[model samples]
Target: MDLEKRHEPPLRQTPEGCLAVAIRIPVRIVVLVLVVPVRMVWDALVVVGRFLRDTVFRPLGRALSWLARAVFVWPLVALWRYGVVPVGKALGWLGKVLLVIPLTWLYRQVLTPLGHALVSMLAWLYARVLTPVGRAVAWFLRGTGLVLAAIAGGVYAVVAWLARYLLVVPGRWVYEWILAPVGRLIAWCARGVLWVLEMLFDGIGTALYWIGRVLFVLPALALWRWVLVPVGRVLAVVGREVWDALGHAWRVAGRISLAVGRALATLFRWVFVEPVRWAYRTVLTPVGHVVRDVLVRPVAAVARSAGRAAREALAAARESVRQARADFRRMLLGEPRRVEALDRREPTGPETRTLGSSTTALTKD
Candidate 1:
């Protein structure tokens, strides 16, 4: 039996081994029952997720992106390219044709010619009327200035000559004729007075010396040496001691008071003044500056602009009124009437009498 068992094939190669495999078929059945449905459900879920991604989510995402681009970006691009750019170019072309070209032509044709005509008229007026008038006035003024200078020179010469004659001649005559005798007489009188004064002063000084030696000098020396010196020494010693003690106490008290005053001042400044100063500098000052700059300055500027505009309007109104008055007058009366009226108002020769007199004086000079 051992030989037959050893010579037999392995169980896997035998028919009974097939029966043992059949006996364990419940495990395979259980594995297939549990795992196959789970795998199929997992595969079905994956297929559904892929189908949803491709069919619903991806298309929806692409549609949303396309809708955003169409709604927001395409209109703006189309507007910039087709509407705004074309409109801007058309406006630029219209401006160049209507405003710039016409203005340039008007300036070159009408305004430039008008300006040149006005300049020529002004030049003619300046040359014909103003030039001669200015030259005549300048000549008159020059003659007047020359006459004034000549008169001033003559007056100065006369004054100088008179001064020399009056002062120098009189002074020389006085000195030679009257002052010499007077000065000699004064010298003689002064010498006599001085001699008398010298004699009197010498006698007086000798008497004063004797009187002071007896009455004042001896008493002053005795008083000072005997009484004043001892009293002064005692008083000086007592005063020095009192002054030293009082001065030392006062000095110490003054130092303490000064220290306390300084400390109090520092504390007061730190507590009160610094905060107020800081608040004023940081808040009130800036606010005041802002009010001045932002409110006051703009108001002043606006007022100035309004005043300038009003003045210009008033000037234009006045000019219009004057022109209207002139036109009304021209319409009411003939041109000859205005000319005759101007002629009647013109000055005759008598009106220039002062000027003629000045001219005559200038010619004479």
Candidate 2:
């Protein structure tokens, strides 16, 4: 039974036996699992209580502190406001007056008179020169515009008169005197040239006849004597055969040449007419799109960019020129300026005499 019990399970101890028994279980671990956790919870509650006390009471303490500060410092605040703020404001005013003194002195000494003089000068210039210049410019522009308009109107009138005259009388006169006469003269000349060409052709025919007689007839006669005589005698025996052969050959060559000429003419017509017709339908019909996208659009863009750049450059140049003129005038009217130390001074009389002698010697040399 003891062996079975030992083998089966260890019996649990009672509370008194557990207290008396020595075991490996740790008391500190027991306390940590139960008593320590309860104590930690109690300490956490205490900490929470202290935290609440501090949090809930801090504002009151601060209020008391603020109340004490108010009771102590209210009079001090009033005193400081009366003493320091007014003194500070007075000092600020004094500082502003001190700051203004130099500015007032400068205004009285230089700026006021400069301003008045500048205003007076500007007013005088406006009255004396500017008004006249503006009036003159306005008049000049108006006159120029009038002149341009008159010129344009005159040109339009003259053009209209010329057009009317040309359409009515001068065109007819030109047709009669110049065009008709010239055409008649050209026709007459062409007829004369045709006659001359006919005469020349007749003369050339005569010359060719003579040349044939001189160059080919004798030679042909000689060839006939040498070769054709025997051949002719033979051909005389077969005259129909020879004539048939020659006629057949001539007919074939003529047909071939005619066929070639007709083919060439057809090819020329196809190349010049058919391709042009097709291109007119396929490519040339859309030529306005090409012009707008390729030629006209790019040209317009370039013109706009160039015009903008040119206008900007001209404006900048005009401003630069105006500023240059202003600077030149200011320099001319400005105070006498000190010369650069590096610049040579004018020679005294003795030095100039010596320099003249040296120059004369140099020239002589």
Candidate 3:
């Protein structure tokens, strides 16, 4: 591919209307004039805010965090670690001693035996006395229940025969022979009435549905399709155009502001910075070099020479003091013993140890 084609932007080539072209130039020009100062002011504020955050706000926040830790967090931690923890442990020990130990002792030593004795007594009573009495009472109740059951069976048989003859047979005969025809006629009439009501309600429902369509649904649909749709489309077109204009103007204004800022920077550099830089480079640099070579070097050399002489004098004085100290020591303690250095090594190999000489045991002193 060609370089120009390869480097070309990948955006779609959508065409705008005549309205957009007419609006764009004026909008961008007006926006540039309006937005240049605002953009510069915004950039200045951003720089200032960053500076404050770096130099002032960040440190302030860190200091606040440290102060909070020292004032609130550290004291609370110390209280929990050193004060509350020990107090809680002491209270726990006291509870174990005064309450828990005594309770455990009572449960183990006194209450356990008492509970066992009560359980044993209850068991003995149940097994020895209450069991026999309950058996006797159960036998008596069983005998009485048999007698009552016989009496109840006799009464139930008589009542069953009477109910069959007097109530059940008569009710069955009346229901099958007399009432069945009337009930069937009534059911048929009810079915007809129900079918008629269903048909009537169905007609009413269809009518109501048509009425709702005419009164509510159709007009609303017409309003949406005819009036609202066209109005919304027009509004959407206007809004899209306005938004596009705003974006285009903003980009143009940014470029204009950037150009203005660069021009101002160049002007400032030429007016103020270049002269100062030239003076420093051409005039002040030479003067400073001359001063360093003439005045400063001579003064430094003299100071260094004086310092060297003082150091030599101090070194001589120190030597004299050392000799005097040595003489005083010799006069007080008398002659000192001399220590002769010796080399001691046991060689195990057939090699010369020092000065190419043998170190064998056969070669005695």
Best by TM-score: 3
* Tens-digit lDDT string for candidate 3 (1-365): 57656575788988977766666667566656676677767766876899999999999999999999999999999999999999999999999999999999999999999999999999999999999999999999999999999999999999999999999999999999989999999999999999999999999999999999999999999999999998997676667766766676677666776787689889999999999999999999999999999999999999999999999999999999999999999999987988985665655456647665646677633
Per-residue lDDT, model 3, residue 272, is 97
Name the regions of candidate 3 deviating beyond 4 angstroms.
1-45, 173-219, 247-365
Model 2, range 1-365, lDDT digits (tens) per residue? 77666465778964533322222134333333444434444555776788887998887889998998888788799889899999999999998799878788998999988999999999999999999989999988997998899889989999999888768787788888889988988999999999999999999899999998999899998898999787876555355444444455445544555565578779988989889988988898799788899899999999999999999999999999999988998788975568777645555675554544553446643
State the RMSD for candidate 1: 54.0
Return the TM-score for each candidate structure. Answer: 0.25, 0.22, 0.60
The candidates, ranked best first by lDDT, are: 3, 1, 2
Error of 3 at 332 (Å): 31
User: Candidate 1, 156: how far from true, in Å?
Assistant: 86
Report every candidate's CA lDDT: 0.81, 0.76, 0.88
Q: What is the lDDT of residue 263 in candidate 2?
A: 82
| Candidate 1, 1-365: lDDT as tens digits | 77666575656843444433443444444444455545555555776799899999999999999999999999999999999999999999999999999999999999999999999999999999999999999999998999899989999999999999989999999899998999999999999999999999999999999999999999999999999998997666555545554455455555555565578779999999999999999999999999999999999999999999999999999999999998998788856433434555444685544554543546643
Better of 1 and 3 by TM-score: 3
